[model samples]
Target: MSMGVGIGRREITGMVVGAVVLALLPMVVQDSYYRHLLIMVFIYGIVASSWDLSLGYAGIFNFGHMALFGIGLYTYGLATTLLGISPWIALLAGGVLAALAAALISLPILRLKGIYVVLVTFAFGQLVVQLIISQSDYTGGNQGLVRIPSFHIPGHNLMRDHKLGFYYIALILLCCSTVFLRLMVRSRLGLAIRALRDNEEYATSRGISISRQRLITMAGSAVFTGLAGAFYGAYFRNASTDVFGASLTTLLLSMVLLGGISTIYGSLLAALLLTIFSEMIAGLGAWRPIVIGVLIILVMLAYPGGLYGAIAAAARALRRLGRRQASP
Candidate 1:
């Protein structure tokens, strides 16, 4: 059976090649600052791709996706700072808690659609922020949690290596996430998700349980998103309510759009592109955001399919030219 474009051989080969290059990056680019940015790119890539799973595939306007990330972040923060647990254990705990939160939120939004889904999810995020603030002594409220634990090695110190350990960890996490999302989207469940997204009524008539699928869709998407969140906290050694803010939400949303909806890998590409691009224009200071916003708008207007679409178009054009040349 044929799968989606995201699962094609060409795309898979590209992913593999890209992964190899990224794996070799640390050796070539030893600068800690650049490595820091790449780690962030990996983290954002995981979050954005997970968001794509729900928003792009299932067509769920889950505005609280970042909320799930925050849950993981706080879970790690509190676990390490309060409970005195290992950072490794706290990381997994974070993902688990986020997944649970996603499942719970899915129940309420199951019957809702479109903008209502957006509203409910967005409200859920705000509710989480308020809860964290109300529990200031534990969460540090507005000040957030600081001096959170970082990952430890048996012999070597993590900090001494210029973030090499964290970079590899982030890369591995992103790779796992990308593989998971792609597999899910190419599976029977993924087909049902797309079907439901296109026509809920028709999908239901075919015996696809809207509730079950929707629940899985929401929960599955949250897993890596939560992990990424936990990683963010661990990497930064802190947790902040600021994660639930609109800025991150907007940036990730732009990634999903700029990458091309329904293509899991596209979001990752967008993450890499946007994160680096945003940093490159940092000298613009006040104008940096304006430049990015304008670029995104122009790109979207010119190519509705985002980067993936533009690439596909260029590929098609090259093939056409090749064929013409061969015919002569």
Candidate 2:
């Protein structure tokens, strides 16, 4: 019981430290250019965290997550632009559509094991991108859509170009997303997700309804990631296949793996760290992917559990040192 309590306390401590760092970000870094980068970090942070829901928790490797994310982007944009709906309503619609899309896709694919799930979802993601390109009538085809409506929060305008407003709005979503996901991890459903991830057959034998849990996890991930997609569309004032492309999916997957798979704060830390690295190494341009790939390889070879596991190990070592010092 005390060990469990210690773990919870550690999670809270890490989250608080993260929040503090984010709050002090604008103050330490006054440049608007870098501020824009911070907003992007927060934006991608949402998608990465959402990805962790299934891939991390449910032991389900889904590579087509960006498809649901793209659906959210296109769904909200088309619904609002075509039907003349409000942005907020469109946002809700985007999330709902994303969840529905996950459900529709997961019905058949969720039954498959790890590698099969990856392949199927990857195909689905590719299909969504292709369909968007083929149907120029609705999606503007290869030309993509420009100047989609920006984010509006009651009185404030949350445009990506507007550094301060964008930061605050994104921070709210980022914090809320983290808290909500953490609670789910602590809840009954969270336990089920872990169980399903560890051993689907065993979980099913225990009457855990692995299929139902997979669908729920997929839909839940889709909803938040879809919101993230909507936000990305609004931020850039545009929506395109490239934004929801396989590249984004792969990068997000790295954030999960390189940070620590199945760990709640894993994606958040990875997103922030990678964003900062990208800024520092912008001159690498397209070769950035290669660098990221190499880094991931090195991390996996050196630390099996990624960054969080390394941190945990270090914390344990420090605790041991303190205990030894206090010994009579």
Candidate 3:
């Protein structure tokens, strides 16, 4: 109990210090380009962390998570640009819509096991992408939506002034997502999800409702992913079918696996690092994807538990070494 309390206090302290540093980053960095990259990092981090909630924690193996995100992008984009709705309200609406979609999708596939669930979800995502492409008149089709409005304070354009406002907004979203997911992983629901993941039959025998747990997790994951999508549309001022593509799904999965499955903050950190790395290699042109693929393969082979797991292992080793030295 004391050890757990000590660890909890350390985590709290780390989070507080990290939050303070992030809050002051804009003031210290002063580079609009870097700020933009950091904003992308935060956006992807939110999406990745939310994805981890279902995939890692609950073992849902959802491959269409990006589709939920795409739904939010289109929902918010269309609501604001076509229907003249407030962006803030549209953001909330997008999340609700995505959550509803997730619940609906999970309903039929609740009984599916393993790869079947993955395939169905992947097909669902493809279906969404195709629908977006087919409905060019409304969705902007292949050309994509353009001239979407940015977040603003009436007279002040947030995007016009160095993107600082968007940065802060993304920061707040990331922080909220991190805290929410952290709490979720420690909650009773999370415990039940883990139980189901580890032994579905045992969990079900113990009176844990499999469908109920999955539906809840699916909906919860979609909510944050949708919000991230809404933010993406606002930040980039565009919506494209690419948001629902397999590439992004793969990238996000890589982030989660590379960071450490079931570790929310680790996934967030991986998103940040990977986003920055991708930016750095952008000049490599066509070779970028190959390089990233190789790097991911190497990391997976070397550190199966991912960067976070490797770091934890190293810390444990160092502590052990220190203990031995003290005994001598």
Ranking by lDDT: 1, 3, 2
Pick the winner on lDDT between candidates 2 and 3. 3
TM, every model: 0.91, 0.86, 0.92
Q: Name the candidate that leads on TM-score.
A: 3
Can you write out model 3's per-residue Cα lDDT over 24-73, one digit (the tens) per residue? Answer: 99998888999999999998999999999999999998988999999999
Model 2, range 183-206, lDDT digits (tens) per residue?
776777888879877877798788
Off by over 4 Å in 3: 1-10, 316-328
User: How well does model 1 score by local distance difference test?
Assistant: 0.91
Clashing pairs in 2: 136-141
**Better model by lDDT: candidate 1 vs candidate 2:** 1
Q: So what's the TM-score on candidate 3?
A: 0.92
Residue 254 CA error for candidate 3 (Å)? 1.0
Candidate 1, residue 9: how far the Cα is off, in Å: 6.5
TM-score, ranked from best to worst: 3, 1, 2
Model 3, global lDDT: 0.88
